[model samples]
Target: MDSNSFFWKIQAGTAATPEAVKTLGGKIVRVDAEQGSVETSFEGKRDFTNPTGAIQGGFLAAMLDDTMGPALAATLNEGEFAPTLNLNVSFHRSAVVGPILGKARIVRRGAEIAFLQGELYQADKLIASAVATAVVRKQAKAT
Candidate 1:
């Protein structure tokens, strides 16, 4: 596998199932999902920090977006899949290099759209939050 593409393996199974989350020298501590909620954890390492010695803001935003986007996407009915159309994130605090946890839930699911909210936390403190909207598309062709 290519180096950068390795991160694509960080995926959880559909519904309530757990899946392996590939680490770029980091680890996924948890990934639990209920009917409308999904929670995930990621261990931050030195490589994830910016030159300024703190977790980069883009990294924090990616965590929040992934958490929120999937919480809605995973809820699609059979033969359907959802993809993020727009994602907006707001930073409330900086996340240091350490373990960070993120949680998300579907706020609403309309006929063809879904709205979700999620947050990233460091050691139990909120660092950032995100809101996302997705368009439900027909499932892609299976390999």
Candidate 2:
């Protein structure tokens, strides 16, 4: 793991994973900075379910956002961060309360922006997919 990589920092416990990610039960599984790709696993808790007992679409969207954001974050230089500008998600099949795998990769990247895509899967079935754009920004230095 490159020390400069944000994902590596999170994995090494040098930096804290966000509370929202914790709520999603997210864990970083693999990262390939050169390839601009990452794999994450999330526990879809029953609390995330809707009236149909399936995971709510909003939670699934958050999972996808968490997935795709890291794909770009892993490649960022130290002291830099990317905030999602827009996320467009499509729900395919309802997901149950269990382990869900997320895979994401950078589709394109420019100096200041990146385009990303990702999918959520459970039991080898696609649960949802998403495309997102993010703008890279330098972290503010503490005064």
Candidate 3:
């Protein structure tokens, strides 16, 4: 199915499957969706200067992984899903405490594989970029 249809299906409860949604300490919010990508946001209270204020590198990796998985799923046929095999992220600058948006987009789709690109942004500023490889799984036939 197309991305729009897939999005609608997930939103309408006819399809879309979500893994989890959580609010980590320090204005960090994350959501994992079944159809396409995971997204996380920071409320801007966390800064990088202070010892406890810094946004850890692991957190950044998690955000990218989450976004990449679902992006691959978005391009799948019904009952199909994608799992990440590899991911890489580059941080451009420190993310402020304000609202941050992470979006993942699929760049390549194949029968059993896909490539996805993700970006984390704070308002108009680009904070990070990610690329991932996903393994697409075919849906089992209903008996």
Candidate 4:
């Protein structure tokens, strides 16, 4: 479970299993390791819509996290994990069941924590954006 391999799995569309990426229908578009960034797009399944027919904000936030967390996670060495500490998201417009693009970049990272920024685009229009903080640590060992 190294970041580099994770990036490749995503790029190959053979990402691990039925986890968050699978659930979100995230397909990796690009991973720029030198810049600590990753890009993705989601299926925008209509079932994700809210009462007003707009995609739920939580779903959008998940996409943001899915993008940014992986951008940092994929940089981690084997046995290390980056878990979100906080994520602040802002909605710019309603998304109505269409293409969704997610992009994330690591603002800063170190031994303890990472700061990241992410954006969600609906047909090339910004729909939501987020800033996240994650703490890095060794993956918990099995008992």
Candidate 5:
């Protein structure tokens, strides 16, 4: 990893992780900045499950968003952030409360927009997948 890369800074603890990421038990596993791809892991707590004893679709969607967002974020400049403009998700199989794996990549990138895709898996079974568009924005300078 390039020492100056944003993801590197995150791994070095020089960046603040979003509360939503922490709440989802998100952990960065691998990054390929040149390829605009990333691998992430998440924990699906029991609280995330629905009455059917499966992790709710909303929680799975959030995991996919977290994964795809970071794939774009990893390639961003220090002052840039990407917020999802739209996310389309497909649920394959029901996920249970446990460890889940995520993989994401940037499909295309423009000066102000990015297209991304990601997948979620549990015990090697695909649980969900998503494609998303995000708008890249510059952070406001702090006074």
Candidate 6:
């Protein structure tokens, strides 16, 4: 490992699940292994609409989770995974079905724990933000 290649491990099929990337509709704009950050852009499809005609909050959380989780994951070595212990999200505006953007950063990471922050943007507006805590540990690879 070159010390700055953690993110590539995920991209190169060495860690995590396929759904971690697939659920975003196959859109990953950037991954910065050296900075421990990841960025994503996705379409807020019509299938995610709530009864009142707004995008549901859980979907937003999923986007935030995927973004922040990978930011933490990109820092871990092979055989290591970070599972979310808790995630706190705040909604700023009602997001409709449209283009959505997300960016996450690993704030503080220790031996056992890591802190992450993420922001969701739509039309250049800050719509949602999240802070997450996760545990880093080695897990058996699925067969």
Give me the candidate number with maximum lDDT: 2
- Each candidate's clash count: 0, 0, 9, 1, 0, 0
Predicted structure 3, TM vs. truth: 0.66
Question: CA lDDT, every prediction?
Answer: 0.67, 0.92, 0.62, 0.84, 0.91, 0.81
Collision pairs in model 3: 10-16, 17-34, 36-70, 37-70, 37-71, 43-97, 44-97, 44-98, 45-97
- Against the true structure, candidate 4 reaches a TM-score of 0.89
Candidate 5: regions farther than 4 A off:
1-6
lDDT over C-alpha atoms for residue 104 of model 3: 75
RMSD in angstroms between candidate 2 and the native structure over all alpha carbons: 1.3
Give the per-residue Cα lDDT of candidate 6 at 59: 89
Weakest 10 consecutive residues, lDDT, candidate 1? 1-10
Give the alpha carbon lDDT tens digit for every residue of 58-89 in model 4.
Answer: 99999999989878866877667778999999
Best by TM-score: 2
Using TM-score as the measure, what is the rank order of every candidate, best first? 2, 5, 4, 6, 1, 3
Model 5 RMSD vs true structure: 1.6
TM-score of each: 0.74, 0.96, 0.66, 0.89, 0.94, 0.86
What's the distance in Å from true for residue 36, model 1?
0.9
lDDT of 5 at 9: 82
Ranking of models by lDDT: 2, 5, 4, 6, 1, 3
Model 1, 25-138: lDDT tens digits are 223344343466777777666777888888888777777766775565445444666778888888888788888888888888788888888888887788999888888777
lDDT by residue (tens digit), candidate 2, 1-143? 24776767887898898999999999989988889999999999999999999999999999999999989988888888999999999999999999999999999999998999999999999999999999999889899
Provide the clash count, candidate 5. Answer: 0
lDDT of 1: 0.67
